[model samples]
Target: MKVVIIGAGVAGLSIGWRLLQAGATVTILDRAQPAHGATWAAAGMLAVTAELEGAHAAERDLALHANALWPGFASEVEQASGVPVGFVRSGALLLAPDAAALDAMRARGPVLDAAGARALVPLLADGIAGGLWAADEAHVDNRRLGEAMTIAYVKAGGALVPQTAAVRIEQKSGAAVCVLTPRHRYHADAFVIAAGAWSGLLGDIPITPVKGEMIALAPPAGAQLPGPVIWGNGVYLVPRDEGGQKLLLVGATMQEAGFDTSLSPDVRDQLRAGAQSLIPALKQWVLADHWAGLRPKSPDGLPLLGPVRSGNIFVASGQFRNGILLAPAIAQLMADMVLGKTKIIPAFDPQRFAPRFV
Candidate 1:
């Protein structure tokens, strides 16, 4: 099977790796550097239990499956590429400082806690109201994972054509024939449109962007937060490496913003204020960087996966906030489906978004 995957980010690269392992010819085409998009910017929180809210049932299961695969997948990638993805099992702290925040956090207890109602994370700042401690879920250094996956995919004999963006998906005889790029027309036995936020703009389907603003903070000298990833409503912090450098990633303002990825200082400050309030330890941390990513989010919050009505072209996007968390499992399911194997999750199938009743 010859597969041409669009977008060389986590979703595309991981799937390419699987397909190549299955003795398939894989070529990944991207408009920019591999994994440099949202993948590079993501905080790499693999916390399925911590990152859930009023998400769809299908989305929850898909995220859970992907979260389960990260440990083994991380080991395999590190072995293949000689690079550690900074995978951490340090668990997570769902902390809420005040009454309002604690109320919201407490509401999630029924879903994340073992008992009918209880606090998960053990410690409290005396006034720390309530939260969940997800010991099984954690995070990865996404930057390392992206770089590692690129190396792994290449070592697995996958061809990567960076800076090559597909202009459109061309159809012939009621099926996708070739992906028309500005420089050349590339055809393959199959095509997987894993083009992140740009997947919907492929002229075949309605893919939209969900803007997520993030900030990175490395704490000052002789100061360190706990090892667990901490979340308090809108603000969350994940420690980077074995130091005080904790990357603060938050602010998932879900508006129907088109593809405008420019960062808003107002939004950044608002996020910073919220994070500092939750983790007062964040007050000493200096802001390292700020950026925004337009995550591909669908109407139902579930990713659009499986073959499209355009034929021969599969859609693997609309990951929304869970793009980083869902990468590994989504790749496995898509790769298997493309190779005549059983899909890892059926609800992600693109047919669910078909126009007839979508």
Candidate 2:
């Protein structure tokens, strides 16, 4: 089958690679450089329990399944592309401000006293009353993953067209037959919109761009960085080793601003303050970098992973913040669905918000 995917982010690239492995000819088109969108901008936290504590049962199960698939997926990508994606299972620490919040956090993981938490991360502020240690949590280098996926997809014989923005889908007899672009028309047996925050702009996918800003911090000389991800103060500090240079990535301010990726000074300061609230010693850390990316959010805040009203056209978007963590599962699921090997998940049906999309 001939398949054309819009959006060359992680989702699109992974799905394309999967389809190629399944003997389908696939072409991925992107508005800019592939994976430079949310895929590159993510913190790469595989926080199944930490991030999905209050999530719905289905979403929780999906997250767990995705988490389980990550190790194998990372290995496969690295072997295929000959690039390291920095998949780490270092776990995470979730700090609670008080006893009540700590009580509520027990269900997420093993409860830890203040001293116990500080033992794991000595730099933790003294004010932390207690915390949860989630051993199942992990993280990846999302930027590296994107680059590796791009190389793997191309190596797998899939066509990847960069800077080629798909303008619209042309449907015939209630089935998508062509994608109209500025320079050329891409005709295919199937079309998939995995365009991250830009999915809704292409068609009626009902995705909105939620802007997030993040900052990279380098610890002061001779100071130790947190061994694992620290979640607290409305932000997360993810430790990364970029070519032996240790850095802590503190993130993410969610704004409903549309498609604006400009960095915010106020947001940067706020992130630093939040990180410092969790780890006091960070005050001496140098701010290495600050940037932003837009997350594709749905009205129900769940992924849309099925065919639209137009039969042959499908959607694998609305992943929001979990895009990196969910990439492996989504790629397999979407590929199976496209190949008629699996069924569409009802809760994640693209047409769930009916009239709004059609």
- lDDT of the candidates, in the order given: 0.77, 0.91
Best by lDDT: 2
| Candidate 2 lDDT score relative to the true structure | 0.91
In the range 223-331, model 1's lDDT, one tens digit per residue, is 6545777776567777777333455455445556787888888888888887766656666778888887777877777788888775578888888778888888888
Candidate 1, superposed: residue stretches over 4 Å from native: 97-126, 242-255, 343-346, 355-358
Tens digit per residue, CA lDDT, model 2, 1-358:
9999999999999999999999999999998999999999999999897779678787887899999999999999999999999999998988899999999887666899998998899878887987888898999999999999999999999999998999989877677889999999999999999999988887666899999999999987898878889999899999998778999999999999998898879999999999998888899999999999999999999999988876788899999989999899999999999999999888898888761233
User: Can you list the residue pairs that collide in candidate 1?
Assistant: 121-133, 200-207
Worst window of 10 by summed lDDT in candidate 1 = 113-122
lDDT value, residue 141 of candidate 2: 91
